[model samples]
Target: MIVMSVVGVTALAVGGGALLMTDNNASAAKETPAQQAAARAGMTVKCPDVATSLSNVPQQARPAVNNELAKMDSQVADAYQRLAEPGAKADQESVRTRVLDPLTSERRQTLDRIATEIEKVQPRPSGLDSLAACTVKQDQAAAADAQAAAPNTPAAGNTAPAAGAQGTGGQGTGAQGTGGQQQSGPQRADFVDIRKVKPNVKNPRVQGKGSKGTFSSRCGRNENKHFNSDNVIVAPGVSNGAHHMHDYVGNKKTDAFASNQVLESAGTTCTNGDRSTHYWPVLRLQDGTKEFDAGAPGGGTEGNVGRILRPTSVQLSFKGNPVSKVVEMPKFLRIITGDAKAFTNGTANANASWSCTGFENRQLKDKYPLCPKGSNVVRTFKFQSCWDGKNIDSANHRTHVAFARADGSCQQGFKAIPQLVQRITYKLAPGARNFAVDSFPEQLHKPVTDHGDFINVMSQKLMKQAVSCINSGRKCG
Candidate 1:
């Protein structure tokens, strides 16, 4: 009867202990994964004076402690694996709270104290392997603890993109940021460079008055008779009742008010093309003394300032084929000489006058060369500046340092200029003043006398200087 009573009391005690344990775990199980993880991270394992307490612990307690420790090991391993697995962070956090949180506050503290006592009882090991192992465990524990404490904290919530993100767009945020840079690209028009052909005033073919002449030669027309060439052809409108071809210049005839550079002909596209002339620009050297060398010509405009400014040549058109022709300067293509004062001071050019059919009074429309029976005509001219000392004052005559051809016609007769056209005004030599008349011998050119003997003496002196230079130096010009 006494034995039964003892057994009943022991059973009641065991039931109460189990109920207490269940009560302790109920709160932990109910907690969310994130809450549990946060609680475990915040819990501290206070290392106590475990060595003193362990002396009084019963030998039977060792089994319970070892069992608890083994369970902790498995739980830690499982938690680590889950945390490492793809997309299992939330689940792993939950497991840590269920298993690790309870131990962190009590069991872990007791275990840490016990470990300290054990270490005190035994000296350090001879082999460093244990130390290394312990170090690794400590590092892992620290990392795990940190993760649990701040599970939901953002790594870079407020910072800008990292430096490495420049090239990579999305996966690496820093790289993506870098890849969004805007780049400047060149424009299409910038890549295409066009060089316009300058007009020439030294030629004769593009000048003179028009004439009432019939088609005398088959040079400009073909059997099929089509205006396929580059010449500007003009003729009276054909009597095609259905096709009303408006004349190019319309009713505007060749008037003095029109530009001298090109004839003011009909504006309409002429079906029976007749009058056509093509011209090119002429280039002159910078210095007034250089002679024309065809091998190299100048880069800018070219012209002469004699009795009349004339067109030297024209691109002829037969039927549609271009024919090379020569013509004198027309009355319209005259060049006006600038004043000597302006030349000395390097002033802008004067507003010169020009007439397509001679000055305002003597209109030369009747003298205009008539087009072929079925053709019309077009006219164009070019302005040019010249500096030959023949007629110009020595002070006004610029040194011819280079020469060039616009139509490629004078290329054979002139040397090429080294400078660009825009750079011309800046490169002129300063102080080109005229010399006294007493310095020249008689019988120089009549044109130079008209201007003054200033150029003659200067030219002579320059020629002598060049000769002396050539004698002294083998490479001198």
Candidate 2:
């Protein structure tokens, strides 16, 4: 199941055309423990992920199908917003009638259009309509249960030592916002103290034939503030396809409409002339200050309200496979690691790893870490290290690349390639818990929804240099 968002359409209405209003604060204050527990259990829209179901879509039909997919995302987002409205949950029957039913109809139509487009050039995908229906289900119980089941004992593994004494937390007034917290998320269960997590990271042993070198690109920490809600990799040409703001580095012109030519000609932040684009959802302090996009499509209006936190450090490094020599990635190769809609879509594709600078050995896939007084929050992404050897892109944007197995080996037909490891650190006040990553309105800003997007725009010569340095077992920049 997955969901998406946009502006304006109110999916739920009280009496004909009237908006339902309630004093949530007042009513919450009077609830008993049992009632409060029930209240914390929020609901979200869950629909089958249509994009992942298709493969081998004709290039001519891709634009239309992608547009339809974006529309489906918007439909989910709009429906989720309506579900989050005050008093909407109190009337489940009304919600099902007004919101879910209409959303299903809209999605069905969009799915049909997508199939029609694909049929124009290729055989129509079967059963797309079956993916249209969505359901509203409680969102918090599963996460809470998973948290409770997490191991408490330390596991045998190597851990990255804390970098150094923590720097001051991010620059902000640390003020609480008047806009209030996101209606559905970042529950107490969503955060865990780093001290409580066991060291669970275990690296595969490097074989004798391994390419043991590393190549790093010095891309600035997005100091110029390249931000947008468009995703050129998955939803090219669709504005606000992401439904959340992303912080970008490297490529200067990377909106949804930017073609490969535009990206190649664009100025870059990388010192090595690597025009590759690296981006991820911006983390925001839940302090109620209105950001520049507060009322815009992908910000406050879409249920993402907070002060954006700039990363204290962004490290982009390409490392070699531990089992075999690596191949140079094709120019314009795009890779998306982690699922942006993992909250409702499930963790099958969720690859987000959260940890504290000092406790990098203990990675968290679902919960955000509360670092010690001197430790900073860290988000690390170790992208796919194998490619299908032919396609630079895929119908689902993931099939072209894949992660290596536990022994650091690529699958039967896939070729091992340089693995991009992105590590971003953020300094936050000790014990701070009011922080979350930007996400689709319906995703409820869950930590599991954290994801990273990358496009390899390096020139052929530069890529050759990187591969040569890696295969020769030398670290280069």
Candidate 3:
């Protein structure tokens, strides 16, 4: 076997044998039982070779672009190597900072560079294009590799798992592309296939003339990484903060231990007489500023990290039951939508709705549309108001509260409560560019972790008034 240095890494014989990777401080450490027992499966992490594809690029751009890709690939390999090492951080915090965040950033930077370089090519490639064509190639290869893992694929907690290894320790869950089945864990299942996610809402039960109303909240940019308050709702105030921070809208004070009593007494950012407790992750500006998001370095959430998409409109409305009667929502009812556990492993369960002030027709994904002068970036959220006569909260963070099926009828055993819809808009001064949503560092700004939480804390009078708005079909401000 012969050796040569290519871009600081060595090349070895063309056979499947021990590959020697040398570094100034390299040492050969023997394997330990703990390390061997970590992962249920294994995978190879390396940058895809773009040399063969470079032949299609102009000679002038080939060398420069190839170098750029090589750098990206090297970064990926290094990340994988570190993640695979024995005793790597298997916990959620460690995985995000050590694996997800760095990898997400690296992937983002690489794709951005590839996009820049691809623009320089005389004959641009078409189809399978976003940032760089290589992304798709790499993902496809990864998917194949994941599918080929043996023995149930071991939940990716070990095996240097990037196969959606955002902490699928016991479930045998692999990452999305790795063909892993993520069940609302660190990585959520995919966004239910964009095709199935049709924008055309069905059954159109948006009834009642005055039930329509609007309200706004400036949840602020995600200033701190404490938004959702991990495991707080079920257990009053344990951590008392989320892996990220949130902008409080309706409630004047919302914290980890906030109770239904406190929320009712709290003031709201909205001027409308309605006083429901509404909150969501804050929106952020893209200025290269780093914070400790769940997926970001110094992040703290177990199931954290992902793109924080700019919301187009935070539309608000009310819903009623089959009887068309306005019923006050039970006090202390807590409802949460969207998965916070959505990390970059393609387990994002996102139904993010984004749009422009005037360009309402243009709903976008992955990329936030740049608003023209004077227009605002909008974000909207609708909550499920109908509740099962039994539980206020569920183990999955959902299901206890149910959404009205297309017919405007609550399923059997569920009672309809006055549900409020919120839509917010952000006017980014004038000529705003490079604006990004606040997200877990590992989200890589992919716009998937968008979610909302609400607690029914309205006073009896306020609750009735709000419910009347929907039942009477009157729009309240």
Highest TM-score, which number? Answer: 2
TM-scores, one per candidate: 0.13, 0.85, 0.51
Which residue ranges in model 3 land beyond 4 Å of their true spot?
1-231, 270-275, 289-316, 319-326, 343-349, 361-367, 370-374, 429-433, 440-442
Q: Which residue pairs collide, candidate 2? A: 4-77, 5-77, 162-358, 177-288
- Give the per-residue lDDT of model 2 (tens digit) for 237-261: 9999999999999999999999999
Candidate 2 lDDT (Cα, whole model)? Answer: 0.76
lDDT of 1 by residue, 380-436 (tens): 221232222122211112222112243322233322211111100011112111100
- Quote the RMSD, in angstroms, for model 2: 9.7
Cα error of candidate 3 at position 310, Å: 12
lDDT of each: 0.20, 0.76, 0.44
lDDT of 2 at 226: 94
Between prediction 2 and prediction 3, which has the larger lDDT? 2
Worst 10-residue lDDT window for candidate 3 reads 177-186
Clashes of each: 84, 4, 41
